[model samples]
Target: MNYPKFRKSAELFGVICGGLLISMPAIPQAVAQESTPKINPCPRIFYEEPHNNQVVVPQGCPPNALTQRLAAQGLLPVPATPSQEQTNLGVGGETPQPSVKLPRPASGDQTQQPSPGAVSSDQPPLLQPRQTPSATIALANGTVNIKLVNDTATNVTFQVIGDTAPRSLAGKSDVTLQGLKAPVTVTFEREDGGQLIVTPQASSEPGNLNVTFNEATNAAQGRSAMRVEPNGSVFLN
Candidate 1:
């Protein structure tokens, strides 16, 4: 009986070893390696054609062989030529016309004369040159006294009559004849009516500045002289 028990135990141990062997899994196989993606070497090219059979390469095309060939062969469009009728020829071919001027009117050509007793241009009544009167200028202290002989009028303008005198006299309503330093012929003119004026030459001192008055043109209405005292008093002789 004991020998059979020993045989049973050996069978049990063999069954358990078989079960362990079945539970263990087999080793996995190695995965296959992947290759890298390769990039395309050439870029795309686009062409535009506004006219038939005329291709235009836009700016973006690269300077590769294909683009250079297209540009050299003139596959690109060409600008149109202008018609001959639209051209500008200068004015060199035209002729100019002549302009005409009209004649002017004629003026009077005959000479006319005035009758007797009327003023005549030929042999006009010899208007004796106007007779100028005698005038005198007296310089005493700081005052100047102007006197006229046979002067019927009141308003008169007297001026120094020499180039050496100041171009114009100073400090007088009318022109001052006393400022003439050299021997000057002073002239007295009447503004309204005829009057006599006596003008004297330059004097050394104020004692007596005497000037003779005579008709400027006639010289014969006799002569008159005026004496000027140092006290601004004027005496006619």
Candidate 2:
């Protein structure tokens, strides 16, 4: 072949081979599939010490899966002394709020300008007047104060006021909740292989609930537990 024609043919072959290589299917990259979490079995509470008990499961189990959620609902392992304690949670004596006493309407005279935002009714208040603010009562700023202390050896995860993600609390630590607009359920769950739990002690009132996370071996089965519900009731499980 002529020199020019031969060179042109070689260039064409090179271009065609390059195009074919470019159009070929690529080798599949390894697709990174998310692994499924292993299923965990029901948790068990066992005696860790002569005087204490703990709830735990084996390794490779999903952390905080089965038992922690149950504890938050009052369905499992509630404290034994929720109601019997000397302190009354939501109950109290009547103490009238400071107010400007208006002149009494003359007997049988029902017609009067109603106070702004006042509902005139004979029905009594569902909550009787609280005596001077005790510990559990709402504060002057209207935030209910709650204190949680972790007294166990292992770390724990907790949720408050309907939050789904659990926050970690180190052992021998304390946390207080303030400035919450609504009542909340506080749940504390032991991490996998953990044994201890949190318990709510009696408070002076309902707005400020105090709790302690103590050793599982030292706790009363079905008695020592997570904090009381936001509604001011204790659950025994």
Candidate 3:
């Protein structure tokens, strides 16, 4: 070959190699920029305490809705001390909340429970007081004639128990029970809501008794007037 032609071709090859070497660094730099990931900035942040002189930083951010709701409810996390600055803080999912404690009752504030068999003061008594007879007339040993007069508005029932059968005397009527035994037990009950006020008048003729059932009096004066003596004699009113 010719020397001048050889020298010109060699210079052209060097220019091409120099241009390729310069463009090689730019191509790799463009490829590296396209492959690299973009970093997103966190809107919220949380700090982690240092342990063993090492602290870990987290890339994730805390939730906005949960933090705001807790703040409205007065349940936020405590902050660090003002003297110390927090560094390399981490963003965690959970937030530290304050613990709630209820107040305990004092010893004097405790309630006293009533006993099982205790009775209330406002309740009425279970048994009523026994009544006393207005008057009593003792019968003689022989047989007697007795008369019962009902002066009430309703019908009255009188029984000369075991001496004779029971009899029902109408309202404003009279009944005569004759030849009854001396120790007779007589019971009277009204048909409606009224008690019999018996008043007795003993005859001086030896063996006659007049018993009258008047209108209903008060309950304190005794509903009836009769008693049985220990000597087998019956006193009636």
Candidate 4:
């Protein structure tokens, strides 16, 4: 064998191997760079408004004419694009909007039935019956006997004009003034400068007068006088 010739062939083989190694690394690096995804430094900024609407904008990004036109027309913050994952989720690439389901009537025919004791819609409502009035019987002519009852919280003084002297009846007390003439006048005043109310309770008995004096708070309702008429009719003033 020629030794010098073999040495020259071996040197050429080593040079080819070194070139292949350097070229192989460059191919892998180019492929890796092409496979890497590019990311935008300025993604959309999202913020909530006072009305709970989301406002989206590319705040620090380059301005686009379409985005500026929509914003000028008061139609800013358009809906976000559905992502690739959401598109492939079998929802037909549409985001489902929120919905509210109201309660329906129980009837299968879609018409609500009237509840128990409820008035029918087609029928007229029943009215209350008219009350029958009682007959008023006239009293016979006689001397009137007056009974005064004080159902109050304070002491009251009353005077029957020309029949009995002025008398003071305590709280929750009663007094009888006998044989008062027709057209009897009685005046009452409270010891505490409060108010007094006089009401005639009964004249059912012949020649008998039954009256009650009650305390009152309203100035319009506080009356001071009671008059017994000749025919047993009563009046308060």
Candidate 5:
């Protein structure tokens, strides 16, 4: 064969072998599959107290041999056992006391203890019954003063005075009834009063302040109003 022909044949053979090697499937890389770490469910043994004969076990011990032994000897609370969910969550397992032993009084002692159900009359009466506040409305300088009958430590809150009223007032003292062109209704709340004080604002304009007092919601037993006279005397009644 000619030299050029021989060289071409050799190159063709090499290409075929290379293609076969490239097409072959590859071997998988080796990897170590890790197992999940195991958690020890048992309680630590180091908590055993030899002096008190107490044992602290892992949280979820059943009411079996160990618990029964501790209870029988009065080392643990009687009838106290861990719930199933608590056991699953891992809580509870400590023996605190062996038992409570009550000592008897001396034989010749002439003292008597009151029965458990007895109450002593000498004890001071409970703090005076809380008094309910009476409600009254006082108006000054575009501000309204809701005087409660009783002194309350709590802050007073108020709502606009109608069944369709919105929440508009809340303060420690003296709520400002704003946006008043004519008259508006107001409801007062006392910290101790069961009733609400419902009164209509005396309108500067005729038919402007037409409001009804809801006795059910009125903390004040009576209907009251605040008005400013030309003499500058403010009548709050």
Candidate 6:
């Protein structure tokens, strides 16, 4: 516990350290080397899209400490989607094909097909072209005779292309429309009240078209619609 005892202890400690230094195994220079970052992960896999620009995280690997530290520095996901309207038109991609207007509910504006062997316009789906019924007819011939007979007891007014004027037939009355052309479409609308079954027999040569009105159709109720095809085939909806 005295100064001499401490001095002796220090001398003995220095001697023991010197001996250990001479006998101990040498530490190679490898301890000073640093390891590269595991950014690529082991087995190195990557995904180009959807996963963004970052490499895939290897399974069983420790959490990415550097990535967690700089998570905000990665690319923002907001810019990936297109924003400009023109780009959305798919400028570099195939232009989106236009979708035809399928028959909507209660859209009565439907045209009928022309006569047999008649070149009809582009028709609706499952039908020929939209008939060019919206035309003005010339009464060059003496008269196109169309016998209009109303089976139901309801007055109905009828009109179509190539018609000089709209004609009205009384309820349950049979009338012949004279001085008309062939391939004339007759559209009927109920005048008095209730449903009217107006049938037109083209009692003359050539073919005539009859357009069916699809108005006030209620799906909940048992109401139906009529579709005229390019072949003049009528379909009840």
Q: Which residue pairs of candidate 1 clash?
A: 134-197, 134-198, 135-197, 135-198, 135-199, 136-198, 136-199
Segments of candidate 4 deviating more than 4 angstroms: 1-141
Q: What is the lDDT of residue 218 in candidate 1?
A: 38
Alpha-carbon lDDT of model 5: 0.44
How many Å off is the CA of 228 in candidate 2?
4.7
TM-score of 6: 0.27
Q: What TM-scores do the predictions have?
A: 0.20, 0.33, 0.38, 0.40, 0.19, 0.27
Better of 2 and 3 by TM-score: 3
Q: Candidate 5 residues 1-237, lDDT tens each?
A: 599999999999999999888766432212222343334343434223451234444344444455566778997665445555445444223333457887777877747767789877777867986433222233344443322221233434445454335432332233334444213444445434444334444345432332333333433464344343322233334
RMSD of each: 37.0, 36.8, 24.7, 23.5, 25.1, 22.9
User: lDDT of model 2 at residue 136?
Assistant: 37
Models sorted by lDDT, best on top: 4, 3, 2, 6, 5, 1
lDDT of 4 by residue, 131-232 (tens): 332112234455666788889988899998876688898999998877766777889988988988777766677666677888887899898887766655
Q: Model 1, clash count?
A: 7
lDDT accuracy of residue 143 in candidate 1: 46
Q: On a 0 to 1 TM-score scale, where does candidate 2 land against the true structure?
A: 0.33
Q: What is the lDDT of residue 2 in candidate 3?
A: 100
Q: Considering every candidate listed, which one attains the maximal lDDT?
A: 4
The per-model lDDT (C-alpha) reads 0.39, 0.52, 0.61, 0.68, 0.44, 0.44
Residue 179 of model 1 has an lDDT of 36
Q: Which regions in candidate 3 have their CA more than 4 angstroms from the true location?
A: 1-141, 222-237
The total of clashing pairs for model 4 equals 0
